[model samples]
Target: MKRLLVTGSNGLLGQKITDLLVQGQFPNFEYIASSRGADRFDAKAYHYLDLDITHHAQVLKAIETYSPDIIINTAAMANVDACEREPAKSYEVNVAAVANLIKICEDRNIHLIHLSTDFVFDGEEGPYEEDDRPNPVNIYGEHKMAAENLLQQAACPWSIVRTILVYGVLRDLSRSNIVLWAKNALENGQPIRVVNDQWRMPTLAEDLAKACLVVAERNATGIYHISGKDMFSICEIVEAVIEHYRLDASFICKEASEALNQDAKRPKRTGFILDKAYEKLDYVPHSFGEGLKLIDEQLAKLQSS
Candidate 1:
């Protein structure tokens, strides 16, 4: 049997992937989840290792020990503003760690599936295809782009899965997503300012997790644009959430991109075309409404438990 390892196993996508694996989603492979700290999950069906991908020696040691056939790298310094604030830390985690993984994969002949983001695009175009040029506007995107370049030029088997606006719930509530944030804010009757300019096809965490598995299963190569099919401005995204949960939208205040003096510049209109994924990987994503329905179900389960 083959062995599969995932970094950032405490994250939303990681947890979702773990959830599927526990349900026997990939019975042919053994699942090993590694994070920077102690395991946050309650499930014991898979092995968990405390791994900081930033440390080259540590990462090399772990890989040497685990001897995984495939590695899904979900670990990243994902916060745009945070990356902008701390360039050194961001590069260490996002770029250097990937270099380490690539080197190990090259030596071991391991297939690598790396998670990326839509922020690599400049937002000048909509529904980008696989071969579109990348012009990252911020530090986070720059680091991710660098990692992609390394993978593309590497000798080992590699796959890059780029997604947009991923959102979902974790049992520990360690992080918050757009859907959960909007629902909670509106539920509490708190007025919110949502940007009307930025646009994205938000991805469900579970859908992305499944996409990663499909890529590993097929050992798919090159870039695959994986995300929801629909397009919506940031404001429209919030409005849809409001509509889905039957919440009051009177407190929503629409704002433009410039007015929100954010630390990092975000792409104004960057969504993926996903034709290659549908054709090659046979990957299909849920609609924004359908994704919201799943989120509601998960939320209800969390509350009941």
Candidate 2:
């Protein structure tokens, strides 16, 4: 709680967490955000440690150097299709890299706040709870689920937070994120073909960062389901974006098949059941409309910039 380290500091969630920490909004005692790259930030308040989790020596070196009480591991090979194609790399980074980090943290008795995904559960029984069985349908989910199991079996203190359909963020220079893709596609007048059948709770990145910090502050352990307020289809999100910008609604249409070189099989519904979060973490996510409005507001700012 006092001294902390957050991996994947350049990622969507990582960046938001850094922003919150810099603004003194995060409840952590003291924080140091780590990333694989030397991405510069104006966070004059907090410390930054640039280290790649994929490298064992670097991971151990950072842990030794920082000597943090808590390590939040958000670094992962999260690209679904890419993971499907490169299963070995996915296992290496998402599973093996995390195992290495956990081993290092265990040696020091440091708590780990590991982020997971809703994809771990196949769409069969959606609105999944923390105790529900995970039967991953894709390689990405498979790797993440394996990592979760590793954390659970380990002797160290760990908390695994599983989330879904994360979005929001504008100028993130990272490669594996979804928000800028939607904005860029829309701005270019490209027809956004979204899957109407797929359902999920798309949590905004800002909200997600706050929720994570809340869990960290309360020293909450075990699995927690975190996401947006309401369920929505891909097409629904596209329509919301179109309406937000007052663009041609026809530009956002539903595709019959969501499959297009999709190496990883996606679930029709990966939305989370967040009653535990509400009760335990006191998490209050924004409604679907509210979430969409926030995205549109951010998009408007991006347009003006």
Candidate 3:
């Protein structure tokens, strides 16, 4: 049986990957889910290991112990503003840790599938292909780009899955995604200012997980843009959320990206063009509206439980 070790198992993408492996009925795969803390999932059906990817020793020990055929690294210091404020911590998690994993994976001949973001692009030219040159506007993107560079120099077989605006549900996790955040604010008659200047093809976390699995199953080498096919602005997405939940739309204040005064500089139109992923992995993604419905169903189940 092929063993797949997923890092950041407590995270949104990692949890989705775990859920699919345990519940999706795919055969011949034993999964090891590892995160920094305790298992976040209510069901204890899979092996859970505490792993901190930043520490080289801990990373090396975990890999040596599990010896997985493939390591899906979903762990990242993803908070844009926080990454700006603490560049050192960001570098440790995003760049140096990835280098450590690359070395280990190289020696062990384990295929590594690393998750990345669309923020690598500067937003001057977008709908990026796999080969697009990256010019990151923020510390987070720079670190991600650096990690990608590390993989390029490694002898180990690797696949980089670059995604954008990932959103999904999590069990027993207080983390809020764009979907939930919008729904909550609108439903409670709370006002929100959404940016209309930026554009993204928001990826559903489940779809991204499936894309990662597909990459592993095929042992696909090189980079792929695995994100939603539909492109829309943040305001449009919030408007869709309001429509889906039948929430009050009057409270939403549409604003430009400059008005937010965010610490990190956002790419203006950095959505991916998925022709390569479509042709290569035969991957398909949910529409923004479909994604909202899925989130609603998941939320209903969570509430009832």
- The TM-score, computed over Cα atoms with residue i paired to residue i, of candidate 3 is 0.98
The local lDDT score (0 to 100) that residue 86 gets in candidate 3 is 96
Candidate 2 regions with alpha-carbon error over 4 angstroms: 172-180, 299-305
Query: Sorted by lDDT, highest first, which candidate order results?
Result: 1, 3, 2
TM-score of each: 0.98, 0.93, 0.98
Please state every model's RMSD to the true fold in angstroms.
Answer: 0.9, 2.0, 1.1
Residues 1-305 of candidate 1 have per-residue lDDT tens digits of 78999999999899898988989987887999999898887598888999999888988999999999999999998989999999999999999999999999999999999999899999999779978999999999999999999999999999999999998888888879888899899999999889999999899888899999989988898999999888999999999989888999998999998888889999999999988989998888888888888877877899999
- Error (Å) of candidate 1 at residue 183 is 0.8
Which candidate tops lDDT? 1
Backbone clashes counted, model 2: 0
Q: For candidate 2, give the lDDT of residue 164.
A: 90
User: What lDDT does model 3 reach?
Assistant: 0.90
Across 1-305, the per-residue lDDT of candidate 2 in tens digits comes to 58878898888888888878877786556888888778555456678877889999988987898898888888888888999999999999999999998898788888888999999998887888899999998999999999999999878889999989787754544443344565567778887667777788888888888888887888788899999877777777766666665667666656754454466789878788889999999998887667667766765676788
Candidate 2: pairs in clash: none
The local distance difference test score of each candidate is 0.91, 0.81, 0.90
Tens digit per residue, CA lDDT, model 3, 9-46: 88999888888887955566788899898888646777
